[model samples]
Target: MNSVYVDLAIGLVIAFLLFSLLVSGINEGLVRILSIRSKFLWAYLRDMLDGAEGKRSWIPGTIREVFARLPFGNKDARPKFDPLPPPVRSTATTWSGRLYERLREIDHNTSGRTSIAFVPPGRFAVAMMEMTATEGGVPAMLEQLRQDGSPLYGPLKGIWDSAKDDAEAFRKGVEAWFEGEMQRLTVLYRKYVRWVIAALGLVLTLFFSMDSLEYGKAILTDNAVRAQVAATADGGAAALERRLRDKCPEHPSDPYACVTEILASPAFVQIVGNAPVSVRIPDTGDPQWLWNGGDWLNRLVSPAHWPGFLVTFFALMFGAPFWWDILRRLTGIKLRQPDPTP
Candidate 1:
């Protein structure tokens, strides 16, 4: 085997994996800042609450008389309706209060909070089923609510209207409402996530004085460093795989379990065991490079320093699994190539 080329390949793999780990950590941090979980909660409550900001009023309302004493409509419909003296009128409570209460029961953080975004939707839905249940159960009550022009009639009516009142279809439609909202937010989040990656990558490069062009050249030319990095890569990757076997079983998209811990492992310590080379500007060949302020900007877009940082950020936007796949491909190439030794 051509140990030198294989070693250089390993060095590159380790470098990529190192960046992948850093990117994963940054991505997770960005997601936390973006309140990914809370956004879904907001989407859930938006469908249920009235007067929620940014709501589409034209959409049919999903409200129901949540406080009704019986599954049947108007109290006057009962034979013994309102035995009290005449002129005893009262106002009904809005679902917002009860909905908040429902959410607080599951996510205690929702207590005393006015924001609809804090409400946990799945729990609220279950609570509604329990509270509004009848002999025919939640579906039957929903059917009644639909006909009575309850708030739910707006968002869910189309499903029952089109699906011939299929319970599965109604459930799917209700679930889809929240999922669709979340999907839109996801698209926006992805854009912000990329921006966050770029910002974080910039800080990382500056902090470590990392120059990808220099590192690539060093790995190719410094035989001792390349050999050491290759050895580290082979062992470190194997160790990381063993550790990840349980955390990432059968799924590549499950947030790549324990990324921070894996990155801190002894294997990583060994991989970067050598002192880092100093970051330096790559030769531009432009004679006026020293005279121009634009040279700074030029270096950023150059495929060496800041641009390299951007490349790292862009790759990391795909998450750890993606780079791991690339590592595997690189490893495969290393295995297949014939040794160049005499």
Candidate 2:
């Protein structure tokens, strides 16, 4: 096998192995870093990044429930829910959170510090999964509170209790509802983060694909580009005029004879209508053909040749990633991930 091919195979194998191990480490870290109880970090992050904002909604509702249970908390504050519009709600879904989680895992391994980097991402995934699974778990917990009449029931009962003062309970309920919502928000944030990461990966893949094509085009040009230099000597122009007039004495309709006469004319240049003619062959003294006679030049002069710069510029810019990736691998330079935080 060629040496370059051998090197490429070896390099690819190594990169694959490294990436695999790296991803595995990240998975483990996510489970370690994010906690089930304190997962509000993820929720808050998601709410901030994703377009899930609204006036009043389940967020405050959940918060109110939580506060109503507090020992010193007011029994009367009730929470209200206001749903956000579709666009803002959709925007709140962040792929950046997932990206951050993945990057955190990678950094933990690569940073070479305590090597505890594997812990965070592993925990994050677990926390995210739990959040989704438990969005309505609070209601179950409240049901349990109703049956047992436990201290935990105070806040839950107070926020929604028929006996509590309407205004005070509503206010407290809203506070507790918001607090609980903050938890669910973390889950949403994690999911959004993953989404963002997937999106970025797709975009990068597309750019690389285009880059590969352009790089290939450049390589083709290197071997196949034909120089369009003129073939005839400077003085040969005069001789051709003499030939044209003689052969076409009565302007023969025969194409071959007309061509022969044109070749012999001294003022051949003038008879050809002053269009620029390129010489056909280099270093040959006896024969030369006009470059303008070919179909290629005819096409160039056509009306369709309008978008010169746009076509040329696009071709030049395309296929850059293939070259870039090749260069980075050959030089042992690492590709940098985008920002770690959303």
Candidate 3:
């Protein structure tokens, strides 16, 4: 009885792991296509350097400006704005404005890119030093910072002052500051990614109709199906793990493509085929299949499938690495258990 329960659990984990891998691959593809990392980095930098007030003030004005210039729209259909001007503008003569202008110029010079997906600390420190430097170097930059009158001015001045005329020291200080901020930025980015993973997991669960309850029952009641799924998982799990680690490194320029390729591999196909789940989509061979919307909808929204759907959704979000570890531990336990005498 215990052996049967263990086998059922193993089968379910393997099935969930396969679906998790698919979700992860799809999410990576979306991330690359949308340039999500670059956009997040750009937004963070904009907010950090310009302050929240500056961002809030410019967004409405920018939207209006964009809509106002639309050639096809009604000439009088422009979005209404407050009669009062924004207290802070991107082009105003404030510290943020000046910094924004310099950064824009730098960005334009670098092949007209508006955002960079990655920035090394050394390069960032160098850019900051160059932005502050004048004909008189550190002393002039210090004086300029003192007169800037922005909230960041004090922190900027202190960083420079602490350097005590050593250019190398100043650069190191800037790098440290950037690294500290990056730690917080990383946490924020992960929170955003968690939501993305959850959403992708939900979509996959609905599309595949991977009801965990149904799958569990199938594995428990059908000895052949359970054995097939378990054997495939035992053989393929290590391969999948290696593919994720090795393939991505070999093709660093397009890790998402590598993930997609892995999903489409023969080994993965075998694993998925052995699983007992069924796709809810109607077969296109039927003449009226396209018109059978009610049948399709009924299968998708059936109350009996909801529990399994939720289970699959949460499992996928837990991700492939997690299930891979669980599989390893379970397999080890099974191997260590003493064989029963015939």
Give the range where candidate 2 is weakest over 10 consecutive residues by summed lDDT. Answer: 223-232
- Each prediction's TM-score against the native? 0.48, 0.19, 0.60
lDDT of 1 by residue, 86-141 (tens): 12121224343334444443442323222233333355445444434421554565
Q: Which of the numbered candidates is closest to the native, going by highest TM-score? A: 3
Q: lDDT of all the models against the reference?
A: 0.47, 0.36, 0.58
For residue 276, give model 3's deviation from the true position in Å. Answer: 16
Stronger candidate by lDDT (1 vs 2): 1
Better of 1 and 3 by TM-score: 3
Better of 1 and 2 by TM-score: 1
Looking at model 1, the pairs that clash are 60-154, 61-151, 62-151, 62-152, 63-151, 63-152
- Which whole-number lDDT from 0 to 100 does residue 180 have in model 2? 62
**Regions more than 4 Å wrong, model 2:** 2-6, 13-190, 210-342
Taking all chains together, the TM-score of candidate 1 against the true structure is 0.48
Task: Judge candidate 1 at residue 79 and give its lDDT.
Answer: 14
Worst lDDT 10-window in candidate 1: 74-83
Error of 2 at 268 (Å): 53
Query: Which candidate, 2 or 3, has the higher TM-score?
Result: 3
Candidate 3, position 163, lDDT = 89
lDDT at residue 201 of model 2 (Cα atoms): 32
